[model samples]
Target: MISKLELLDNLKEDTGQLWGKMSAQHMVEHLIYAVRTGNGKLNIGCFNPPDKWPTLKRFLLSSRPFPREFINPIIGENLFPLQYENLEEAKKILEEEIKDYYRYFEENRDALLLNPTFGELNGSEWEAFHEKHFTHHFSQFGLL
Candidate 1:
């Protein structure tokens, strides 16, 4: 698993992509939202389809790579509204969010975080999801 610090190191303003619509900055901001969600700072409700498709959630949570161009229902196609003015600003905020996210997990190791799609996730699960999620987008931007 690629650590967040390593991912941040590889990420650059000029990083080009082999897939997806997000610029590097957009991707960083997108990750910020995800980290925040995992830290319990953001709650967008749940997309609880586990009852309808029991194996789906387990599959997603498993050690499987996320498909390229998979539309994140929470973020959507257009991308979330920009939280910062430019790439540098976004990167700065993202770094801060990363710190906060780990801090949150440290303080509340047993907390149950709600995922929009996968329902509730514990710290370890969230860490795994984050690793996969970041790896997917980083690879998307050719950062991996």
Candidate 2:
């Protein structure tokens, strides 16, 4: 399996995905937000009820890849506005964000962060989310 950081290695800006409406750069920018979500920089409320999180988190940490065309309840069907000017910039920042995600947990060993789908998650759990998410999007662009 490719590490999340390496998932972008060969992703091209115009690559057509097996599913979804996102362009390659849009996918990269989307992933940048994901890293922020778990690293204490971005705060998002859980959409699920408190009692649902344990089951959701277990599914997130599981080996099953996210189903193609899965809808993000918080984000909906539209793509978020892209932050960087281009694909290369977005990908570069995504790499930096992934590094920050790891560094943050290293410095704050017990810190927990909120994810809109999974409630509060510790470092290891966040890592699992990242793994699943990266695989999902990378698969979208056929990068994995």
Candidate 3:
């Protein structure tokens, strides 16, 4: 349950350091992309093959934390280009996307979400995934 308030509170002038190339702004923008994908705003297919989906989904939903400094297939190498002009703009957009994420589940409870790594998931699963994801990145920036 990593809320926007917590994220905003922890986002200082100097948030991230040395783990990866993404600045705090870049991390926010990256999160926005992920949220968009979860809410069905961005329709990207799963990178993992169908045979591996069950295992991937299980791991994603498990309590195990995401590994640090792992390459994200969706964001790295400018696969999905960043759109924000600055950190403030990225944060604003991410906040809006967070709101939309809740709204999306409220509207479509039975919808199957296709994550680029985790394949199909329901609304509740998507929320859990997001919580884990946000926690991971927030920690990456030493916010947690």
TM-score of each: 0.87, 0.93, 0.89
* Residue pairs in clash, model 2: none
Error of 1 at 53 (Å): 7.7
Greater-TM-score candidate between 1 and 3:
3
Give the alpha carbon lDDT tens digit for every residue of 1-144 in model 2: 126567677888768888998889888888888888887788877888989999998898888888899888867989788778999999888888888888899999999899988888998888888888888888788877
Which pairs clash (backbone N, Cα, C closer than 3 Å) in model 1? none
lDDT of 1 by residue, 1-87 (tens): 225556667667788878988888888888888888987789998766647434655776787899998888876778766778888
How far residue 117's Cα lies from its native spot in candidate 1, in Å, is 1.6
- Candidate lDDT scores, in order, read 0.78, 0.84, 0.80
Better of 1 and 2 by lDDT: 2
Provide the clashing-pair count of each candidate structure: 0, 0, 0
Q: After superposition, how far is residue 75 of candidate 3 from its true place, in Å?
A: 2.9
Q: Sorted on lDDT, highest at the top, how do the candidates line up?
A: 2, 3, 1
Residue 36, candidate 3: Cα error in Å is: 0.2
lDDT of 3: 0.80
Candidate 3, run of 10 with poorest lDDT: 1-10
